[model samples]
Target: MDRTDADGLFPRWIAHRGAGKLAPENTLAAFELGWRLGWRAFECDVKLSADGVPFLLHDATLERTTNGHGAAGARTWDELARLDAGGWHSPAYAGEPLLRLDRLAEWALPRGAWLNLEIKPSPGTEAATGAAMARAVEALWRAHGAGESGGPAWPLLTSFQPAALQAAQAAAPHLPLGLLLDHLWPGCWAVARGLGCVAVVLNHGLWTAALLAEQRAAGWRTLTYTVNDATRAEALLGWGLDGLITDRVDALGPGQPATA
Candidate 1:
């Protein structure tokens, strides 16, 4: 649970969408809620706005999660920012604002919370979006990374799209990257190696004890997704998983440091 090591091993409990189950997901309200609950690390989905700004959002369309409708990528950041991100989740969060990744970084950097920024593209913009996000990350790191002394304690980049991962590597080689997979693909390890990624994030169900063992032996860290049950978490820990991304941050209790 001690994440102070150089291996970029994750915190024991990661709040999905900035404490998704606790508050309006991907909003500042949710992140604040998680931080208040003593959860410092979180996972969030990011996509490029029409103007190329990175915003926190999960769905391809805005209708389900936000007060807007239509493809999220089709809108400019100005347009997206105007929507009420929290109202749909709950009336209590009616005025909650849309969160920008950079703004979140500014907030999280000083707090020692780790962030897993997932590169989510809008349709045909996969490579372009990835590159844009990578460039943004590069700038972010330049402005706030450890070497610069203004960044978060740890910043991790992840993507299911290989092109996006490649873009991140090209844009900022110093930052750690994680390859995401829902199912095992041919040469998955090789692909990860080629991208110079530090970890492989797998769908919880697709991974087996054997797969976990294999990935760990290869010197690649393993993290699973959306696990909310304590028993399941303990089981995965017994399997030697490096991290678990979950919607139930409250269920994790207080996590131990990675060095522990």
Candidate 2:
């Protein structure tokens, strides 16, 4: 899809951080679980290692998600790669390896999965993280032949950090971008517009019918994050909200989410 397509290039139900707490967040197991649950599109967090290699991870620290200690970005890829990213969630997922960004692309593209790659950088390393991720994905997709001719869906890059988005745009202008918001502050639209973003991913509570229509008129797709309630999901889709990034794949009937 064209990077400028305002009609949007996302599935209606996007798996939040890949099935969201269903498996372990940001691990390959989580993504595979989402795909098995029949979700065509998945969202995930990405950050650069100390050596500049891109990898899947959500927090800036390793304690909550992995069997490691200290700052996540401070660790080299070799160190991060050895960490068991899944055991913290449950014993069933013990020994699941940390997923490299390229490794994920390899797995998902073959399975015909779509992605929302959230550029989650650690403090002060946002610029480098974004640039590296953009470069890595460019190489990844190009090798797989993603375009009008048919291959994988174009991955959408998103982030809550302006520096990361800015660096990504500079590095790979053709990739689709989304600006994630905890709240849509006064300057959020301008920041999104300036970055040439296709969407604004907001906290699910922030959307209103008027706001959705207003953003639609402005040519920006509106997506919500981490929603798990069935009633809210129905309401958002009914409101013409472009996408729902959620954890509750089961909230919709089986085979419902992927088709929605």
lDDT of each: 0.81, 0.85
What's the lDDT for residue 132 in model 2? 89
Q: Residue-wise lDDT of candidate 2 within 16-45, one digit each (tens)?
A: 888777898888898888878777788999
**Residue-wise lDDT of candidate 1 within 1-260, one digit each (tens)?**
23432454577567899986778888888888988877777899999998888998888999988889999999998998799888887789887878998998788876677888899998888888777777777676567656554544446789999998898788677778899999888998899999998889998888788989998899888888988777777788778888788887666745532213
TM-score of each model, paired residue for residue: 0.92, 0.94
Candidate 2's TM-score: 0.94
Error of 1 at 170 (Å): 1.3
Candidate 1: where are CA atoms >4 Å away?
1-9, 148-151, 253-260
Candidate 1 lDDT (Cα, whole model)? 0.81
lDDT accuracy of residue 15 in candidate 2 = 82
Taking the candidates one at a time, how many backbone clashes does each contain? 7, 0
Candidate 2 whole-model C-alpha lDDT, 0 to 1: 0.85
Q: What is the lDDT, from 0 to 100, of the residue 54 in candidate 2? A: 93
Model 2 misplaced stretches (Cα beyond 4 Å): 1-8, 257-260
Ten consecutive residues with minimal summed lDDT in candidate 1? 251-260
